[model samples]
Target: MKKTGEKTWQLRLYVAGQTAKSITALANLKKICETHLAGQYEIEVIDLVQNPKLAAGDQILAIPTLVRRLPSPIKKIIGDLSNETRVLVGLDLRQG
Candidate 1:
């Protein structure tokens, strides 16, 4: 349950270097955050090429994966994030 002033959305995007998919994913994620979550969200982008060891921590199996770490139950979406509806659903902003 979200308490008073504690409903921030925490997101992490894991990618391998700056591939085309990774770049698109970041752009899409930023748009979603700005349009949907806005000030109530935070995004962290991690490049696996620079730090491969970090992937194990989040169990990232894909090159471009979006992980939602906050707002209670965690969720993940794997892909370039071109599908806006799917992204919204993954973030729990819409019915999945």
Candidate 2:
């Protein structure tokens, strides 16, 4: 139930500090948001190394898990986000 022109998408990227995989995920997400979502998205990066407890909240069993918290039909994408098509589809950013 988001307002018009007001996106309520809440995204959280769980990573283990600034590793190569984490850096890639961050860069890929930033690029996607800028190119597609633009000003209609909120991305929060969580460092698991700093807070392991948060992992349980999301039921995360893998490193670099991206969780779409807000908005209905929550989704998740694991790994370094190397597959653009998969990431976009998982996040509902692109039509099938």
Winner by TM-score: 1
* Superposition error at 91 for model 1 (Å): 0.9
Winning model by lDDT: 1
Q: TM-score of predicted model 2? A: 0.89
**Model 2 regions lying over 4 Å from their true place:** 1-7
Model 2 lDDT at residue 25: 94
lDDT of 2 by residue, 1-96 (tens): 677865687899999988999999999988888887888899999999999899899898888899998776778899998888888988887875
Off by over 4 Å in 1: 1-7
* Model 2 per-residue lDDT at 33: 80
TM-score of each: 0.90, 0.89
- State the C-alpha lDDT per candidate: 0.90, 0.88
What would the TM-score be for candidate 1 when compared with the true structure?
Answer: 0.90
The whole-model C-alpha lDDT of candidate 2 against the native structure comes to 0.88
RMSD of each: 2.3, 2.1
